[model samples]
Target: MAIDLEIWWLRCLSFIIVIPFLGPHLVAIWKMLKDLLFFMVIIAIVMIGYGVASRSMVYYPTVNNFTTEAGGSIDNSFDGRSVFRQIIYPVYYFLYGDFSDELANLDSNPDAGWSIADHVLLAVHMLFVNILLFNLLIAMFTKRYEKVHQETRTIWHSQQYLFTREYFTRSPFLPPISLIYDIYCLIRMFVFFIRRNYFETPVYQHTRVFKIIPKKRDTIKEWHNFEDAYTYEYAHDEVKALKTASMKSKSGSDSDNKDDTTTDDNDLNNTTNGLKQVQRSLTRLERIVEELNVQLEGAIEKKQNPTTP
Candidate 1:
């Protein structure tokens, strides 16, 4: 709740810099998702190389009901080898193509609860290698990703809407503290988006970003001022229609009462003046009540927290 305004401004400025172009952020996320699949693929490739080098490469071994070919029975054991092959590829990349797939061939039958912690420093080994493998993959993707990022940045930087529009008016009148909190949170999200903008294609850039041009806003008066367009007769027609509906609702024999009950000019004027007075009185009363409530709460608190109560 104790928001620092300085931090808020910093965040706002950062968001302007980071998310001004969303193409990069989108691309980064896409690349990350794409890389997830390749993470396994690259690992498998390395594992195969390791198996070949170590002379431990066996037939693309099937287990767990899997045949060497697809569309075969699900040998529970063959399923196990499929899992091994899965693990083997990534492991090869991590081991610098040094370790064999022998570990994957540890047992024809899986341990009741399978894990590799028994004989090898599995966690440490996996952590170090996965870091390098993932780093290399991300680096490669990011390089390609940044090319698209520059184009987005250039496009957005040239776009005048970023500055022309009041970027801070989403709430119109939220307190400085609240805006600060919002800016801080949004800056991080925008940073994430900035990373995405890098990977989007040119087609994506034109189609999505082009439509974001600011639409002209109609002023309140422009919308609410129907006096010129709607004549006094047009307005009076509504009142007459209501009366006619009321007459229909009553017995047809009593329809004469509807014309007699038609509102006169004096009655309409008085009603309008009375409504205005009531609105003014209500506004004044609301302020007074609010002030009284605050004072009452303060007095109660003072009594509760007196020095020698």
Candidate 2:
């Protein structure tokens, strides 16, 4: 039963591996944590200072009365163990509006001067922590959230690429099967070492586990090329259809009344200008495609007729 429970916990924890795929907003949360760490340091400094001052003020009269006498040991309240309980914790809780306990016996102290000073100090501490520092932290978080929101799509793509690359570079099999694959790789490496052909194999070509498998880079490039070609063809067809429709509209408008001829001519001029801009853009795209094709052809030729080294 315990072993089954442990396995179930492990299965649940495994879902953490897919957290990056869940959303890009996690990046913002990470940034907020970093900001919070720095903020905590500042809060710690403020809390420690206030805590020590307040605790000392409260204990000063008691310590003074004890020191006035001879041969009596001071109480354990002044020891290190009491510092966190008496000072630090109270100040920390005070920040969250739990000040009633601290204020309840404030006026009961014998020294009016020390009690007044403690009150003033607590008021100042509250203003700094509740008003100033907390607001500043909120502003910092808001700025970081906005920045991450603006680039959410780009961040998501980068995260997906990293996740894909991580899995792609690892063994396709899991656990026991992966162990077998590792043994096979070790045997393959040993054979290459014995044959003294290890250094001669290119780093990229060394990962060819199967003889008939194509390179990942080549497959990705082919996919990208196909997508680009399809996009270009679709754009070209849409532009041609738009131009035809515009020309037909202009012709139909020309056959209408002469009073509206001026307005129609103005519309025709705008349409022509827009078409000209699109044509110029298409021409530039065609030039870029031609250059890429030329480069690809030269590369193919070089690969086919390699120069002897």
Candidate 3:
């Protein structure tokens, strides 16, 4: 059976294009996550330094006992003996590393008094991880999120438009049947290209998927009317009318002042300065209006011949 296959072929191409763009969007999100990993590395370096220092000074000390006044020594082996067990384990616990184990051991050492070094290291860790790294991560995420959103927003919208158009225009409902229909469409499209000279065939122009289809002639006419009304010449005429109205009002006021015979020299000077100021302002406005008209005309020309670029 002969069927129109152009729409299906175009949809296929659109789907291919849109699906690959999703990968870039995912990559952008992954790129933003790198900052978080970098932040973690910084904290890990600090933790490693503290671990090494405390392990060297406290854990593997030359004298493993404290001397007392009675000429006896007391054993100082209450803390951990290894760097992993002493420094790393304690820091991990504070940072919620081993959640189940930490929860289980929460009540086991609640009454234990921390060493002076332990207190100082804890403060440093808190300042870096909780205060500095946390805020930096939030700022990095916000910045990256906006950048990624801006980059991918157009692609995402295009994908959505294609999806909606394809779904609404699809003929077959069931997946297996739809697959068969798609295959038939592809075959028909191949035959169509075979019938026509490949190089001589008309180039396909892709219509914007998101462009709203005008259902009524009246609506299209209305759009045409709007375009005509906002043309550069029409806008220029409107500005000119406003300028003429302003000039007429100024002349009328001047004539009224002339009729008043008691007008003083100071009043005349003030009126002259005010008229000069108004003239300057009007000239500035005219220049601005002229610039706007030029820009509008250039925009219209560019829009008319979009393929020039």
Top lDDT hit: 2
Clashes of each: 34, 0, 0
Segments of candidate 1 deviating more than 4 angstroms: 1-23, 35-42, 52-139, 153-309
**lDDT against the true structure, each candidate:** 0.51, 0.74, 0.59
| lDDT (Cα) of model 1 | 0.51
Give the TM-scores of the predictions, in the order they appear: 0.24, 0.53, 0.33
Report residue 75 deviation for candidate 1 (angstroms).
15
lDDT (Cα, 0-100) at 212 in candidate 1: 38
Residue-wise C-alpha lDDT for candidate 1, range 176-248, written one tens digit per residue: 8678877776886666566678755232222212223112223323332343245434545655655565545
- Measured by TM-score, how close is model 1 to the native structure? 0.24
- Model with the higher lDDT, candidate 1 or 3: 3
| Per-residue lDDT over 1-309 for candidate 3, one digit per residue giving the tens place of the 0 to 100 score | 134586676445545445555634654666687987988788787777766664444333344233533555333445656546666765655554333443243334344333445446556766777778778888998888778777676756656666777766785559877888888878877866765666576646453354463555467557555654565455566556655655555555655665442344444455556656656765675677667556755665676668842
The weakest ten consecutive residues by lDDT in model 1 span: 206-215
Per-residue lDDT tens digits for candidate 2, residues 232-266, read: 78767866776776677678876788766776677
Pick the winner on lDDT between candidates 1 and 2: 2
Residue 150 displacement in candidate 2 (angstroms):
0.5
